[model samples]
Target chain A: MSLSISYDSSFDGFLSVVFETYRQRLDVGDIVPERPYDSDVTPSVDLFMQPFHVETNADSASRLRRAVVNMAGEDVLNLLETAFRSEERGVEMKILAYLRVLFSKSDPGFARNPTSSEMLPLFLLARAVRHEAGGMLGMVRFNKAPDGSYIAEIEPKYDILEMIVGHFRGRFPNGRWAIVDVKRCYGAFYDGRHTEILDLPDTDTLSRSIAEKAPPDEFTRMWKSYYDTMAIKERLNPRLLRRCLPVRYWKHLHERQQNLAGPASRPTA
Target chain B: MNLQEKLNILGDAAKYDVSCSSSGSSRGAPKGGLGSGCSAGICHTWSADGRCISLLKVLFSNACKYDCAYCINRRSNDIPRATFTPRELIDLTLEFYRRNYIEGLFLSSAVVGSPDATMEKLVYVAKELRTVHRFGGYIHLKAIPGASPRLLYEAGLYADRSSVNVEIPSDRQLQYLAPEKNYESIFRPMNFLAERKLEYSAGKRSRYTPKFLPAGQSTQMIVGASGESDLQILRLSAGFYHQQRMKRVYFSGYIPVNADKRLPALTTKPPLLREHRLYQADWLMRFYHFGHEEILDESNPNLDPDLDPKAMWALRHPEFFPIDLQTADYEMILRVPGIGVKSAQLIVSGRRFCKIRLEQLKKMGVVLKRAKYFIFNPDVPANLRRLYPEMLRPLLIARPKPAQLDFFSQLQAPSLPAPAQLSIAV
Candidate 1:
């Protein structure tokens, strides 16, 4: 009989499900995150299997980690981590399928064969997340807070706040900064001493706080002036500009924000 | 003039330079420093022309003694001129860095009195940034062609990368365009820096030896400005790569800035296609293991503008066709039209356990539409076998569409957003 496995939405939680799948030898019909209505499912002939809740524990997670490392190489762990971070539906199932292929072999080289059906989509998803993270490394524009901290907000398609925090910490050592993943409702913040991830409040409260601590008008004005003066008039190709810096990214960019002010009213600073 | 006006004049003057890379250095933030450099470059923004604005690319001064025909900052050009005080430039750089608007500075300049004087000022700025500010960000300085060796070395110590532009490929054309400049002045600094880099690297075991141009040196060659053949240009570039160990060779399609009688007519559009093809051929030489002669020989001194260099090479050498996917070596697999570096690596790894089919190749990022003609895979359709290389040539050539005939077509129909095409990996 098929079993519907459910767990908390996290890497360790997913690992716990994998651990239970092997321990019980259950035929997993579907692996999903725990939902409120999971207990209220009406029994049917086609869906006769009971839902199984796999509690996430360190021991079980570590066992699955060891199994993955032994079956596949160490690199597959990174692929799994990056792929698991993606916000795509059925990504957990895909990871489970890929791991199953790896665990089945005595000497599985799934990492080597990136073109395989089971691994290709996972790699692509991981690449997309990485590409977005890389773009954010450049696109993250920080506004100076009144209290000497730097504040920035981003709504990345994937959960990349954790991936990009180290870069900012390295680039701005000793400087207090907070990078909020607006869509994810959490932020990675770095105080002068240490870095931490915190759950953020709503957008209205965040924007109000950001405005209160925003840098002086002169800095933004100077940046806009610099951006406007950089482009050559004769070689103006907006198509190419849009290609390099996509329109979606322009909303948060300092230069693009002030572009609507027109050249006449630009501040001299 | 005010700072904004000065920026306007200087930024416009420096826009024609195609090199905007802020890569190749991995300098960490020093104790009490402002920034750090990541080995992989970060492009902060792109200009209207689609070029990356990685650094605060600007000229220290637009006051030139020599009159180059193609340069906007030439002595005879009637344009607004400005020069930034060293303190002002330093302040600007630091402010921009704090605000996260730029990666670093790509400081180039026009001849101010003499090459030695010009170079000294540039080196002084770099040295001050390194010593006083303790800045760890990427700095690309222009190595003045006729500067003293000591200044060049000092500049290298402070800068991540240095370059001396060989404006015209051929010496004759350079002399014809700018009488004051010559090949020796440009090559002298390049050869000196190249040797110094080698010397520094040889004693790299010692921690005391300071890094000299850790990003290495690069040079720019203006295409279509001179009457030099692609063969000559590629030959010179190969020599630079082999002998001088140059990091990059940039090709800027000559943009008409002034109405010089000696230059190609002012109305003539820049040779964008030729420049693009040269970049492709350059990529072949650097990454794809193709030699200079293999890319462009005496028979074809120029790259075919219609087809990419790899496809053109495939068309010319029909003898090496239908490469078996399962048996061919990694190098041979890389030669296929549709297979890129990533896909070729995948092919080699995937073939160890099982024979790779065409569908698997497509999944691995191979452009099967183009590779179908060149590769012999297990799942390749039987109908594709009837067609020959000659029949595929016309099909492969990317023809301009009927809608593209309109002058304002690009304006009306926006092109899909994509990454910068010219940022080459070293």
Candidate 2:
């Protein structure tokens, strides 16, 4: 008989479901986020099978965390964290299926096997998330605010704000900075001491504030001029530029923006 | 002149140098510093040509004293010239760093008055950045040729990396193309920095000893400018890697920037494909454990532009294959055409649990089409006996579309796997 398990939409909630599955020795058919069965039943689900709602108790979540770490290793926890941050649908279920294989193994080192069917999806998803986060470390551009603070905004595919904050914090320890995820409506603010996530104001309010407190006109103008002058005229390849810096990201870039009046013209000798 | 104008003239002059990486150092921010260095370098942006813009690469001054034929900023070239004061450079770097526009500065300069005077000016900018600004960001200074050893050593203490360009590969060509420069002016400083790095690391003089050239030194050799063969260039690069402990050896395909008689004619395009092959061959030597002789020997001086160096090496040594996936060592497994370092490790790790099958190899990131003939396993059919190297060469070489379709149909498209997808265009 197949069993369906549902839980709150979170990493801890998924771990809670895993703990309950082991405790009851239930044969898990599918692990999904808690939703009204009649309205949101997936086509893949059997018509007869009913899912049992699992409460997200902190005790069970911690217990499952310890069990997985003890059985597999510390690396599995990192893999799960990265996979959980991925935007791919059904990543929760994939992680559960991967852990089920790890729990079945005598050594539990099977979680590290990238070629295994159960672990491959989780590994690929984790790699994708990590790759995006790494790319953002370079592509993220900040502008100086009037208050002597730095501010930048990003629209990333994955939830990578928390993953990349530590890098900026380490690099800019003395300065106050804010990196907002406009799509997610949240921002990570570092106050020269610690970083914390805060709900960002609405777009209208944020844009006005940023416009009012922007850096001197000279900095932006000079930067755009440098970007234009740096490209070699003989080796111009727009295809390669688009490949590296996708058009989607050009919205927030200072150099890619259009219609900025400035005195930063090419110097004539 | 204003900063924007200075930036244009200097940035244009610096574009051809081609070492934009800010990697190999992991210095953290100081007590009240504004920036830190990441070990895995970050590229702030990519130029239109797809080259990374990691550092704010700019020349300190573009008023040249030497007329190198391949250089755009040669003394005879009619180009706008500019120079940046030490204060202006430091302020620009800090402001850019604060805005996260660049990782750090890649400061080079043309000969201003003398090599020593130019070297002193470059060192002053770095010194003020570290002392006055407390900047911990990555700094790569260009060590001027013929500079005093004292200036080079002082520059090393402040800069994370330093480089001196050996524009021409050989001394004879160096004399022919750039009559004012020779190999001794370049190699002397490189040898000095390499020796000083050894002494600093070995002496362990202080508990908090500062690193001298922490990212080590690198040199760029202009390819296709001189008439030197690929074999000679690769041999020289290998010697640098082994003896000098150089961090990187950059290959800049010669761009015909001037109408000099010594340079290759303007009709020829830059040998970018040859430069790409050299980089691939360099990677093989560095990471894949292949020697320079193994990659390009006296027998074959130039690399096959159609195939990668690894595939070329594998095609020549047919006797080494078909290697067994289950039992072959890591080094042997790495020699397979399509298997990279990551996939080779995955195969070794996966086999510990169970014998890796062909499908598992594919999932583990191995490209099976190129590796199938080279590797042997239980899943491979008995009729698929290893053929002679020459017989297999034609199959691996990428053909045009119409011919490729005919070849695919003749080989039974559904039954046999397709060839490896060529990642780099020749």
Candidate 3:
């Protein structure tokens, strides 16, 4: 039977779809991520198959999570979670193909085998997710909020806001810090002890005035001064500067705002 | 001067140091702390010169008592100088660290009064960060070469890493450039910290045992300052790796900061290309299981200006060419010019599932432009670039303008020294 499995686009919701597909032993040709909110980019849907909407069941998701963790191991679970976090288009179908391999015990460790054809697409997606997460761990810059807390805004290509907050919690355990995604208008906040996700509405200036942000505060001025005098004029290589801190991330970083990242200073005798 | 002006002066004075690593140690934030350590280093931002701003690198003071010809902060130079109090430095580090501006502090300095006096201030700032504030971030202290062993030990108790810069490659060259400093002063603290680190690691994991230099030590050698060949540089680096267990060896391309009679001309550009080649040779030694002697010998005393060290080594030895990708082990596979650590691991693991093909190699991120010549596979059609190693060199090397690439043109180097093992008390 050519059945199209529709999920609510949440990690648990997608896992329940996997649980239901196995319970009924139905052959799923495609997986569609159904979102309650409007998205301009229409998701992939297999037109030939009858659509099967699976309601998100927490018990079913938990059972499958335990099963995958128990069978394939924790690292493999992380790989699958990264697939969900990646939010790559058509990733649901790739995950469906991956789960089919996982359910069949012919190659019990197929999830770990990145070179295999079945796991390659998921692996590539997971790799992009991980790379951005690592970059965010360093690329995130914080400015002090008026209420004596740290706040920053980022616009990453992937859904990585949740993936990076754990690092901040570890680095700033006693301080309150919040990193918001301006595109989604959502933030992951650390409140000295626990972390929470909340909708942030006051990030309009972040997207609007990012490039025009001058050094208004003393600390920003110090950082800008430090960054300016740090580079040796004789060894300026723009190619390497772009490679380390990419052009896509320049909007948020205050120092990279102006066109002073390249070789500007002449060698003073 | 105010804090901003002081930061600019001290930061500018400390800019020449190229070692920005914050790796090889991991510590979590303390109970009421401001920062934590990550073993995999994170670069907060890159400067205009493409250098990683991993640390808030600054000097305690640029006021010096000794005049080293290559140093910007030397006493002879009349550049604007400033110093930061321990309280000011501590606050700056904590605030910058709390705001995620940097990983930690890289506090180096010129001698204010004496080595002991300067080392005491650096140690005091680090101790306050560790004990009073519970700052768990990566702290890299400069183990002042001539500082007392007790001070170095005290600094190590609170620091994740410490380094003593051997500014010149050979000891004789160092004496000529910076006559106030000697080989004994440079190596004494290094050898002391290395031995103490060994004791901490080898001893029992007792509760009282403090974590001492968890990231160990590293050093930097200026590339173009002295007339030493690439051969000498690689040998010193290899000894540091093998004997002292150094984590990293950085090469600064000797930007002509101060112009003394002994130093390069003020207008002379830094030897960036030679610095790049030396880094490649260093990588071959550290990661590719290559010994320093095997990289550059007495016959070829200098690294080739055109080709990378690995490619040059491959072309020199014809027997090692045309390595069968399917049959070659991991070490030999890594020797192939374009195959990196990641691609080699992929080839080793990927071939188990299917017979490796040309397209699969490209998918695994192998740069077949160079690797195709060295790899022996049925899918790879043989060409002149592969058949003749000499023909391959011209194709691989993109010849930049003659004047731009020739940093050695100004060398007027002294004649080569004997190739007996470098025994200058490294």
Each model's lDDT comes to 0.82, 0.84, 0.84
Off by over 4 Å in 1: A1-7, A24-55, A106-112, A233-239, A258-269, B204-208, B383-388, B404-426
lDDT of 3 by residue, B83-197 (tens): 8999999988988886788999998989989999999999999999999989999899998878999999999899999999998999898999888999989999999999999
The digit string of per-residue lDDT tens for model 1 on A1-269 reads 68777787778999999988888887988777653322344233336766778889889998888877777667888888898887566888898888888877744555567767888889888988888888888888777777777788776777788999888788778788888766666788888779999977776577556656674356667767777777766567788888778787776676776453332123221
Clashing pairs in 2: none
Residues A223-256, model 2: lDDT tens digits:
7778877887666778888888877777666777
* TM-scores for the candidates: 0.90, 0.90, 0.89
DockQ of each candidate, alpha-carbon based:
0.54, 0.56, 0.58
How well does candidate 3 score on lDDT at residue A125?
79
**Cα RMSD, each candidate:** 8.1, 8.3, 8.1
Fnat of every candidate, listed in order: 0.63, 0.69, 0.75
Deviation in angstroms for B233 in model 3? 0.3
lDDT by residue (tens digit), candidate 2, B306-355: 88889999989888989998999999998999899988987888787677
Report the lDDT tens digits of candidate 1 across residue range B1-426.
Answer: 888778778888888888988888887787887788888999998866777888988899999999988888999988989999999898888877876788889999999998999999999999889889988888999998888998998998999999999889988889899898999988999999999999888843755568989999899999987789988999999988898899889998888889999898888788878988899889888888989988889988988888888988888887887889899988888888889888888788778867788777777779887888888766787777546667878988877776546668668776854445434431
- Candidate 2 accuracy as lDDT: 0.84
TM-score for chain A in each prediction: 0.81, 0.79, 0.81
Clashing residue pairs found in predicted model 1: none
